[model samples]
Target: MKTEYDVIVVGAGSAGCAVAYRVARESNLEVLLLEAGSADKNMMMHVPMGFAFLLKPHKNNWSYQTELEPYLNNRVIDLPRGKVLGGCSSINGMVYIRGQKEDFDRWAAEGNKGWAYADVLPYFMRSQHNEAGADAYQGTGGPLWVSEIVDEFPIHQAFIDAAVQAGHSFNAQVNGATQAGVSWFPRTIKKGKRYSSAQAFLGAGRALSNLTVLTHAQVTQVQIEQGVAVAVQAEVKGQSILFSARQEIVLSGGAINTPQLLELSGVGQQARLRALGIQVHKDLPGVGENLQDHWNSYIKQKTQGVKTYYSEGRGLALLRNIARYLLGKKGFLGDSAATIGVFYKALPQASSPDAQIHFAPAASEYDAQGNLRPIDAITISACQLRPSSRGSVHINSVAADAKPSIRLNYLATELDQQVAVAAFKKARKILLQPALQGMLQAELAPGADVQTGEQILEYIKSTGEPVHHLAGTCKMGSDAMAVVDECLRVRGIQRLRIADASIMPSLVSGNTHAACVMIAEKCADFILRSSLIELVSPTRPFGR
Candidate 1:
């Protein structure tokens, strides 16, 4: 393997893969992409429904448990991050949501220049090949394949009709001009296979002569000299190796790992670094602060006569579905976990849709051994789209392999609690609509007895789970606590940039994979533009 490259991208996940692919494909610069996990050769990594089996402790998953959350009954919630070549995009539900446009506009409002919906739309368009065809909002002819669910069941239609009867509008495209109302979710699946970032970006650029990729190579630290990032120290097969970067080093580790790496590299709070017995290189207090994630709550209902995945996932039915998928790339096995989605305003005072719900004609629970077992039920899971609560992630150990401390601090604020209760109530209301009332037998979770707002809040505190859309650890802005500037360059450090969810100043209103890709597209543009300018003026300093 080469020791040096023009650009080095750490963590070959969603953003990292895109950054490396764009730099290698668009320019003549040499690029190296590193991933801590093994290759994406696992069968489960490609099968859409295989994510169910991967939810537990698996080789492709970094199933880190959070520290006991103070607000959620001191419960330790599971935080599943992808450890494979595509990261969470490979193991995710495959649902493709670009979030509300106001989400990006808010970022631009927060002093993050060039991040508004208008400014970032081009990047979003440049990253995906939406099978639905290109419109003013959607794009085509990109690497990532964005497809609509091919097969829709009776239960899906029933749920959508019920939601509309409950006063929600029926939207054909949630990721289009407006993000409000019920719709069938679009997915990152193409021809029955999970189209992950690794497959979309890395696979397309793998044959490029200047591009190199190494899996199972964990980056331990970024070597800094006089505030300039020079190289990265990585552990490959129990051996330490130093890889130099002639131009720039891009950290694309997601929210948790990015902040943890920054802290480990001595770019965090000086006091915290000293307390952990680590020498400080740059005192950036916001390296691991302003953490954010969607706190998800769900309502499950037992189905009376409806056929759900619970029954179809067993015995001869399971074999039939498998055969169907294998033969024609069509069946439950080829579908995303959630086939329908609802975006609505839970609070009347909110400007846009403040809550989002995902509907599936199936339900499951963890057994005593923590294995996910299917149940005979349907589920409506809800989460506040833009939460006000903020938590943090920081390293608790000096070792690179040690898991970092994750505190979601979910429902810490009164507004968050109110939104959670309202979203839950809204979900229940939709389930009770006449269109779905004949299908649902009874409410299984929180029960019919729990009707009051206080009871709903209590139920949420006990059962809320992290949606795993973690972001904002290394926030990008011009504020005091911002870790990166508007250009994605780390503050007080040169030749270093972050191109993942960690750079989000505020979490988007929906699934984060699309936004992470957009961030990477923009990051690559910045780097490539700088390189072009430097080429024109040979005497100019690099990445100025």
Candidate 2:
């Protein structure tokens, strides 16, 4: 087997796939993409409704969990990271949300150049093949295929009406001119199957000879020689292997694994490494410091009349649904959870929308073990977009198999506490609206008895969980805590770059899959450009 390559892309997740494909197709750099998990061949990874299956602990799921958090009554939430070629995109809700323009502008304002809304919009557009077609804001042709919900249920429309009746406006496209109001979410599904990053980018470049993708290879650390990352040490089938990278070693292991890998490589806080009896390569405190996630809880309610996806894929219904999908490629299995989404300012004093609402026709709750408890119910879940609270992800042990310590520290900020109350009140107004009152039965959770602000706050804390949008552990910027520069190169380290959600200075206002893809797109462009510059001036190895 080949032991060396021009470039090594770690973790063949969303960003890794994009970078590998871009380098293989656009540049001649021999690329090796390594995934800790196996290939994206699991049938569940392709099914739109298969998220329910993938979300559970399985072979394709990393099945991570947080340390008992003292904030949420000492509850330990399930953290599922995709251990497959597509990574989280293969297992995510498939919601194609781009967050707000201000979210990116804030990044540029924080000294991260070329990341303003205007600068990053093209990358979003370039990665999209929206069913809505080409426009100023949306894209028509791209690797990732996005489409509007074709079989949106009647309850979804009524929920939108209820949102509008509750004082919010109806936006035809949330990814259009503005990010405010209620609209149908653009999903990462096409032709009745989930379109993950692996299928979108890697699938297209299968014919490329220079690109090699390795699965079931868990990278433990980067082999740094004289302060430069030249190779990666990995475990494949109980065998240790070293793969050399002539150019660079790109880390795209998302947030948790990326920082954990860095810390294991002795590239984190010096004191922490010294305490663990490991030699510190670089005392970069920011390697795993800034951890953040969007916190949310479902407001479950029972419906008296209309039928939600209460009993999907059970008994004869399963066979019928499969047959129906096979015949026409249209069914509930093809759609994503929730019908309509609302981006609104929960607090009037807030600058932009402070919360995002995801409303599904059916209701389900997670058990203490993080398993889904399905029911004949509807859910109006709201998430605080810009959380003031920040947590951290640190390695618990030096062993690569050991799970890292995660502290979400949700609702630690008073602003989030207030925002939770506002979101509940706003959702209450929508539920009580005459438009939805016909079919609405009762609020099952934090029901009619729980009315006061204190009660609502208690309800949110007890039931609230992360929407799986983890980021900022390996942040990018010029600050002292910034682990990587604007160009994504790890500070104080040569020939090493960290992409994926780990580099996000802050969590975007919406789902993170699309943003992760955009980051990879830009990273690939820069990699190719840097290679061209090096080719022009042989002595100039790095970017000029």
Candidate 3:
């Protein structure tokens, strides 16, 4: 491996892949993209419906469980992050949601300049090649292929109809003019295969002479020299190696690892760093603060006459589906996990959709041995689009390989609790609609006995799971707790920036993969533009 490069981007996940790709292509900068996990060469990773097998504690997945959450009856929740090239995008359901426009506006409102809906739309467009064609909201001619699910099931349409019958409008394109109502979800798939960030961006940049992509390289810490990030120390195949960055060092290690890396590098709370016996470099209290994730509560029902994934995903049917997918890239295997989506307001007083429902024509449960077993049921999982509850992630040890303490205080706030309950009730209402009622045999989870709001809240506390749309640990804003500025440059650290979900001032209203790509697009633009300016400046020293 090379000892130096123009730029070193840590964590070859969703944002890291994009940033490295853009920087290498847009500029002549030599870029080093480092991933702590193995290559994305797994056969299942390419299959659209293969994410289910990758969700557990697999080699490609960093299945980190949260510290016992106090708000959720002290239960530890599984927090699976992708340890592969594409990061979570590889293991995710492939749902391509950019979130509500107001989500970005809220960031601008929180003093994060140049992050409004209008300001960031171009970046989203630039990173996406929506196969449905381009319009005011959608974009074409990009690396990331965003298209509708290839194989649409009857149950998906039935769920959509049921949601509409439940008073929600039918929106064909949720990422278009407005993000509201029931709609078919767009996915990051191409030619009936999972098109992860690695496939979208890194695939195009891998052959570039200026770009060096390394797998199984775990970054330990950023070496700050005179308050400027100069290099990163990483363990590559169990060998300690240091790579110096000439221009910039970007951290794209998602919400969890980015903050953990910062804290380990002594860029977090002074007291915490000192307590860990680490020399403080930059005392930024927000390094691991403001952690947020969507908490999902599901309402599952037994299916009577419908053929869900439960039936088709096992036995002879499974073999047939696999053959069909291999032959023509068609069948149940070519579909995303959740095909139908409902973005609606759970609270009547809220403007726009404050909650989201993901309808899957399948249900499964983890056995005592942690094996996933499909059940004869369909599920409609609901989550507060904009959760008010805030949680945190912090390093419990100075060791780089040690897992960090993740406290996802789900339903900690009154508003979050109310929204969770309201969304759950709304999902149940949709499931009970005439269109779905004809197919559903009975409510399997949170049955008729759990009807009252209090009962629903209790059920949620017991069953709520993280949707894995984790963000906001390294927030971007003008506030004191903001770890990055609007340009994504890390506060109190020169020549360092973060381009990942961690920089989100707050969680976006939906799945975060699209938003993370957009952030990386903008981050690359900023780096390239700054380099151009510095190159032409008379007073600036060249190659300092």
Candidate 4:
């Protein structure tokens, strides 16, 4: 059976929620949002410290893995994306950050018109209702709630001070005029609770009559007819169904699924689709080519006397913390896991923002699941800002339920390696600072004897893995290789648009949630204006 709506938003992620919420609240458009996972009913999803718990297979996430990176000895790295109603933001570290200004300015210079920092600032302001109150760049009363550090710890403060002593600036806000500094990170938490996209957008619109949210509804393909998106084919409870988009279709399925869905619906390379036994609809060659993300080489340190979260003796404390969290939203469950974030240029001649540092207070035992294991661990992760390397994602076969092939051509550039090396040395400096020296017992990951640049380069090559900030599969630009235009409309297609991280021409500096929602806010305006123009002229296809 088929159901129709003015707009069908796929993925219900940070961007998808923003798109549906804005369309429902601002415009008279009826919207339908479909999520691949179940409703945000998991208790762990609401507790900030519960991010690690939700990373289990067949839980609140689609636990995907990359096809082995040769540099890391062909180890398949895990990639956990949110499958719940709010998407990854629901399971993210919850740190609120907007990247450096140059990141956006570069997008405008790269044929993406009006996407620079200045042009998009208003939308960013429009979506935030800062708990720290309004600032020059922040909003006073927007849907997405952002607040300064509501809960602070001693270790977190020392990390911030150590960064300052190591020549980094101490700015209260990272989302300000300058981004190259260490600061107490602002988060999407309101009243000491996790404020996910589900809370900000979906929660606000749940009572609205014009909006319908379906969880466990995985969209397998976009039903395109004569080069236009008409409906979406979804699977719910092992049953297949169709939902039509009356006005337009917005693909917010994120970096991986967005491109895969487009490719499955025959909207990518004709040669590739033909090989997969699928008929071609449009030949948009840039479907899933510009994959980008942050990668970090962890530096582990052993600590003494002062009990750390990752120490062997702290297991019971952690259990007590978990119990405290379940009983009342308190303890480690309130932590974002990431206590500190820093953005900086690796070298003076660096063309744009080059590196970012993530400070995890826990030890090497703190795995990708964001859970703490026994050991005193503090991670100093550095990622390349604008790595020259590029990758692609495509369907493994014609079957709609099959997972896509993700090839991340990591370390394909010498510059990417150089920045990573530089960022590591800098990270070492911060850890070795006198303020932190008392706590650290030894450097375990990369020892003090590893001095040469070549040695550090090898260490990075051998140890680095992605920070999981994937983007740019359906990049927005006007070039031949560009998949979507500046306004986010697909090339050679009508009434279809991509409103997610996939449309990012270059990955933003920090975590992508804030920027993704900002993109949706701007796109909502574009879509609304296009609809208004159509009503007046009753002609024109809403494009360049």
All candidates: CA RMSD (Å): 2.9, 3.0, 3.3, 3.6
- Lowest lDDT 10-residue stretch of candidate 2: 535-544
lDDT string for model 1 (193-298, tens) is 9999999998889788989999999999999999999999999989899999999999999999998888889899999999999988999989888989998898
What lDDT is obtained when candidate 1 is compared to the true structure?
0.89
Residue range 470-514, candidate 3, lDDT tens digits = 999999988889999999999989999999999998888999999
Q: How close is candidate 1 to the true structure, as a TM-score?
A: 0.97
lDDT of each: 0.89, 0.86, 0.89, 0.80
Candidate 4: residue 105 Cα off by (Å): 1.0
lDDT of 3: 0.89
Ranking by TM-score: 1, 3, 2, 4
Candidate 2 lDDT tens digits, 161-250 = 889999899998898778999998889898989999999988888998989999989999898878999999999888899999988889
The digit string of per-residue lDDT tens for model 4 on 1-544 reads 3388888989899999988887776666778989888888887777776676765565777787778776556767778899888899888889888888988998999877899899888888888898777777888678899876644346677788888898888877788888878877788877657899989998888777778888888888888889888999998889988999887889999999999999888899989999988879899899989998788787888766554556422657767876776677666557675767877778768865578777766664556656545466667777777777788888879887788888777877877777878888887888878778777788888888887888988887776767778899999998878999988999998889999999998888888999999999887777777774223222211220
In model 3, where is the ten-residue run with the lowest total lDDT?
Answer: 535-544
Q: Candidates 2 and 3: which is better by lDDT?
A: 3
> Candidate 3's error at 63, in angstroms?
1.6
Error of 2 at 358 (Å): 0.4
